[model samples]
Target: MMTKTKLPNKKLAIPKKKIAPKFRDAFIRFYRYMIFFGGRGGSKSTHIAILLLSRMMTDEYMYLVYCRKWSAHIKDSQFKIFQDCVKMMGWQDEFKFNQSDYSFVCLRNGNRAVAKGLDDNQKTKSIAEPTHIWVEEADQMTFDDFDTLNKALRSLKTQNSFILSFNTFINELHWIRTTIFDKEQQYELSEQFRNMDTYLNHSTYLDNPFINQEEYLQTLLMDNGGNESKIASDRYGLWGQMPNENPWLYAFDKEKHVRVIPFIPSYPIYLSFDFNKNPMTVKMFQMSPQKGLYDSFVHMIDEMEGTVVLREFCERIKAKYPFSPFFVTGDSSGQKKGEVGYESKHDSAYSMIKKHLGLSDKQMNPNGYNLTYENSRILMNQMFYNYPNLYIHPQCKVTINECEIATVDEKSMNVHELKKDRGTYAMDHFDNMRYFFQKYFQEFARSNYHATK
Candidate 1:
């Protein structure tokens, strides 16, 4: 009856020395907006988890919201990280985890941490005022999504903070880059953001004390199979190169290929189309066929999207280039009967294009077929490298953006095909360009055919 009863260890000890030096200060202090972005093995997630757990354990009113792009991703990611941190700190008995909704509560205090996904708007909106919000894989969310989340941290009683942790795989044009990193560098902020305090810290695998012990990670980071972009992003925590690591048009150089190419009204306008409903795309080019293949110039003067109706799109093109004669080429799927939304159910897309634009069958690419994806990739890359005269107008932003970001399927056994699952309009504009090139300059499809000759 007098036997001493053991009490659970309530002490929380975060291995401060074990934490990366660059991120140690983040655990002790608070910033309105804290950004921890870098390469793999940085311990960014570990630090954030520890910080949130510590805050929740100490403060009764502390409420932390952990978010990712998808709800399904939270269990394996942030939720796991928190569980590991709790176990490592020997605080397992002090907290209770709810598996159903991916939440946990500090038994010592009323503080709680819940996981939410940005994709589930209803769940995200249902969350009451949270003292802290952490967005893991922050780059997956657009600026609007981030802004909405940031605005939701409206608790006045506690010191509210927002944390963003992500890898450096995003390109220069990404919202995280343009808004946070770039503006931070330039010391520029709008009136709305001037009141907020922001802190940014970058850490790579080298910054991790235990990185050497993780032999697999070390090898993976060191030997990236000649993918310089991946090495730069995953090892060094540098901004990724535009167009991604395995860009479909690897040979494209924006400075060399994109320029102010004026419209040649005298030359027949070559129009290329891709008929995805949401963002039906078109690219307009004019060619000087009199010049030799290498010397001849094909200037893409304009690009348009979002006019889904074929008649409306044709009218816009006519209004823009009223006097120029036009030639047409597009996705062979346009040849199929009953391609929706672009035209009436009775007429095919090509027939509608011919009718609206008043084009003869001779002016259109008579071939009612599209080049294979592999073939298109090869020919487009070849054109970018060897066809020096091929240029996209500086104003053709959609085409330029596609050329810069469209990537090949690096994971597949056949790596030549373009990756198309990114979004509905992911590669629509790029496909239009490829279709036009393959049909209009069929000779370029031959691997042996030199553009210069």
Candidate 2:
């Protein structure tokens, strides 16, 4: 005969100070759906574990069904998290663990917590009267898997909740962004979902209180191998760019490089052009001095595109910035007469720009010859890493879109050639940007070259 140990009747006290402030409110409140997402080292999983354990201690009817994409992953992830939480809370004796099934039962109130894999639908469905469901790495689950688990929360008496936690690794077209969030490109809570008992919380490694004590985590987050998408999604917790197989501007991260840039009247404006009959494009830029890390910052203020002649495009620029001083640079081919349009057969594209913008030969800085595509790609990507102060104005949507989607031909002998199959003006704006860098910032662009011994 064995004597049963008496369970403590006192309520467990959760240390609020240990919890990141961004997650503390959600720990105490009840919402039908709670989403906690961000970059690594945010302590999101640890907070969820403590919240579930605390609720189990308090609510006598608590039944949690914790799940991931596969059942085999539960033992190492969610199960270990709960086990660590129990030890951290010093509640080891209050719970009975079933190691074989990855579950535990609270000895005090008969509450239970079980781990299931979304891969095993029947096992997840068999969890009767689940009061709460937690889907870790929710980005891995499809809509059907989410629906199945959502419908499993059938307890009529208990206030049911569904929790989702993940890094912002998915693209804009993903169901989580399109269906759940109102705006595809923003990080704010959706007003439509907020009214429907949904709670959203975002955090980054900077939010972790323990980050100061962990130097390795800080170094890893800081050094992302110059991957702009990783820097955006991992360091800043922003929506990642759509993955491209052979991106032309591989280091272009909209999160790091796009922002609201105001025009400075004191700085002379630079216009870079890419001339085409169907749709001519021009990018406007301004340079400002900086104190640290970088000597100067390049601000792409605006972009213009239209199916018009060189004269018409110049008129549009003059109308926009009537009094501002302008410098011109673009395609070396623009130097050839009779190529622009019927309106200016005698004047080359550069000459037409000079005539319309009232610029001198000193201001006209077109390269004598265009840099090879291979050289341009190498130099531009090098600048993106070495000079981190480059930025594009949010209003320059065309430029931003081109930077994100433009791809190169990896199979071609000259792999730097842009993939022309995307569309007629697929890489027009990208070319305009390249021309600006190669002509105006030639010194920085040539820094990557090494002389042969």
Q: Estimate each model's TM-score.
A: 0.64, 0.52
lDDT of 2 by residue, 1-453 (tens): 112222222477777786778788776567788888887677889888988887888775788989898788889999998998889878898888899999999888899988889887677667788999999998877666777788887688677889999888775645577667778447766676667677788888878886673674567556777677877887777888546777888888888999997799888899999886646889999986442244578889999988877778889999999888898998888888876254457878888789878899899999888888877887677666566578999888778877877678766788778765323225778888989988866564564342001
Name the candidate that leads on lDDT: 2
Off by over 4 Å in 1: 1-20, 27-30, 70-73, 117-131, 142-160, 183-195, 210-223, 242-284, 289-295, 301-388, 393-401, 408-425, 428-453
- Per-residue C-alpha lDDT of model 1 across residues 1-453, encoded as one tens digit per residue: 112222122465567665668777776556788788888778899888887888787664888999998888999999999999888778888789998999999988878888889887777777789989999999887665687787789898777889999998775546566677544453243333444566677888777785573684668656777678877888888777533767778888998998887777678898999888756889998988753365688788898887457898889989999999988888888888776564467888888889999988887773477777777777777777766488889888767877888877776777777876433126778889988888866674464454322
User: In order, what lDDT does every prediction score?
Assistant: 0.77, 0.78
Cα deviation of 440, candidate 2, in Å: 47
lDDT assessment of candidate 1: 0.77
Q: What is the lDDT of residue 374 in candidate 1?
A: 76
Model 2, which residues run further than 4 Å from truth?
A: 1-10, 213-217, 242-453
